[model samples]
Target: MRAHIRSTSMHPSGNHIDAEVDVRTLSVALLSGTGRMGVHLSAAWAHAGMDVRVCSRRKEKAQQIVDALLSGQGYSTGQIMVPPHPCDRPAPSASWRLQAGRVEEAADADVIVLASPFHVMWRTLEPLAPRMRGKGKIFIDLTNPWLNTSAPKGPRGQTLPPIPKAEPQASVLFHKTRFNDPTSSWCHAYRHVFWMLIHPTGPNPRCGERLGVELLGDPRAVAVCTAMIKAHGFKPVIRPGGCEVAPRYEISMLGRREKGPDAPPAAGSDPDGLIGPFSASPLIAVDALLEKAARHFR
Candidate 1:
């Protein structure tokens, strides 16, 4: 996509820096889109009229996600054979495509969402680091490092021992290992999470109203991520400390498991009467529980 270049003085830091970004065409590539969160976000973005490329180790699973979105929703579907040259494809269209090649094919995208398992995430991303640098691309971390932990559960069914206090935040580690260089000034990395527990109910389900997203990253990166989150119809929350405070969010998930009415609804199930009433946004509700966990577990 051709980006109308504009130089802006404002950056995440107060200092003046020349950051060139394409605000008009927003394309996203989900690196591990076969997973539940990846599929949900991909479908939401496609539904929001944004271009999305779904990639996975298994191309069949990625293609299935694209087909499911087109069939499950009333969205139109089109196919374009990606050429060898990245710039040969037509301008960004509000459509979803399956990447037939490796993760390297997604490097040209404006945004890359990393939703893979924590164990394999870095291994998958390390090789792509060279292509991602200086591309002004935004990398969003949605992987929960503690996902595989088998710690004892609390009375409320919350996972115990939160992620080890010594473990570094996933986003921070990603930046240090991959994009930590003077030449990578244009690249921005973010740590973000979204809530999508509600299921489609009745003739029309307002799933967006129940879901929310939280972003913590550089100012410019957060701005791009915020716009993407809002486009998907989810409330976007920005944490002031950026990635520095990401550990708190990690710890929060272990406090209290949302259950009964407030817990996330099952896939394809109607959540109309299944969910309990709540006055606050789900992000805030979860944060509150995490705060309590920090005190109790720490």
Candidate 2:
């Protein structure tokens, strides 16, 4: 699918002035930068030339991750400028800097990506809520609520655990209630469809372009989040009703039947393979999801 490019208009002053400009140089704060998914996402955004601030309990670990992201692998370190706070009267100037800081620093960023484990999420963000309130910032939730537990051993000692319940939307609601930042908004919870780790050497090592993201959030915030997803080189599939639809996605994946090694490709009308909703064309997947949702909801 073709990417959606945000449009900008130029005005004729003595100097060419931009009438409107997209937030291309978004400043992102990753609260859990040292985590597995956090590192990949932080690197991906930084690789796309955005100003990224990674936060961790240990500053050294955060700095190491940032350094690895900035290394002259295949990725280029884009220019950075310090922009004014988004809530300020005048539009902020864009600035770029690769740095690691405490959670407090994340309050000033335009975008905040939360990748902490489900159990620790609230405790981690409660203190920062005051700092983040009223910034009109966009918060992206990238957490799966399932706890890791061991299952019974199979004949080959390879038993898999049952899939856990999905509650991503509840996380978003909790954030809003605790933060209560009326000025700010949150995009839907998002998860990568593929499992490969992205790094400076190759951002999309697992052919991420062939996969897509599943998102549930406010339309406006979803649009912004979608742009960021596209910047990371994946198509984004947005479902309405915010985080409410996330459980269905989880159940679908959990209940799917395993295909034999020689199983043929699923037919267009098949619902069995709907659990993994990602596709090279995200709209089609979204349509399928909508149909499934309608049936389930009705």
Candidate 3:
């Protein structure tokens, strides 16, 4: 399947598919870059040379991360710009950047990567979703929400309401996910699908630190995304579960078929888990993943 490309004048299904930017330079926004993991990912992207905007709820924390990266080993020595307070309004000159909020940062970004947890993403995105619709941007969701709780509700997000029991997936090795509704708005707005899943065999998905983008959505978009992610220091591969259900299948992998020691409790034999890390081989991982996922290329 090809990428559903469009511009400011056409919908994903409109007459704008022919003319689309093939992702030259990406303005990447990491939602909660102040946190440990978020900071690490932002630093990695910066180190890899992508124009990035790292945002956090607090200004100081965000600056702290940028400072550490600029002065620390995150970025190559003298290879990056480390400005004081990367997000000072009016846009100052800097290497490592900081953004006080996602809205402003997203305005210049081609791809916005959500580093916030599952429960937090909805609240974080609700106010911004409408403004982001048809921005022709790609959103990378790294939040692993428990299914019963934080799945997106209502398509197009016109209702933009969070579920009652929808809660955060605190760091624990157990507990099944509480999946919420699937009528997700980004499904259409930003053209999202599943990427990567937990394993039932050797290891789980490394908590929140998986290193590959297991694309399972649009073939063209996934292919394009793979090259971009590869440029940004991540292994990119297409996964088996495609169609629109890849995201849900990913959620399911975390629960049934126990994998590693952290597998969620289940009955005797729930089908082991899903497949292992699709991007493992580095040599043939991309080819293998794409070959398996190709069937869903509608």
In candidate 3, where is summed lDDT lowest over 10 consecutive residues? 171-180
Off by over 4 Å in 2: 1-23, 73-97, 149-169, 195-205, 250-298
Model 3, residue 94: C-alpha shift (Å)? 8.7
List per-candidate RMSD values in Å. 12.6, 14.8, 14.5
Candidate closer to the true structure by lDDT (higher is better), 1 or 2: 2
Candidate 2, residues 223-247, lDDT tens digits: the string is 6676777676655655555544344
lDDT by residue for model 1 (111-156), tens: 7788776656767877888887766666777765555432446799
Q: Give the best candidate by TM-score.
A: 2
What lDDT would each prediction earn against the true structure?
A: 0.50, 0.53, 0.42
Clashing pairs in 3: 81-95, 147-178, 147-179, 148-178, 148-179, 149-178, 195-214, 257-272
- How do these models rank on lDDT, best leading? 2, 1, 3
**What's the TM-score of every candidate structure?**
0.60, 0.62, 0.50
Q: Local error of candidate 1 at 126, Å?
A: 0.6
Tell me the lDDT of model 1 at 120: 68
Q: Give the Cα-based TM-score of candidate 3 against the true structure.
A: 0.50
Count of residue pairs whose backbone atoms collide, per candidate: 0, 9, 8
Candidate with the larger TM-score of 1 and 2 = 2
CA deviation > 4 Å runs, candidate 1: 2-24, 72-101, 149-167, 174-178, 182-211, 256-298
lDDT of 3: 0.42
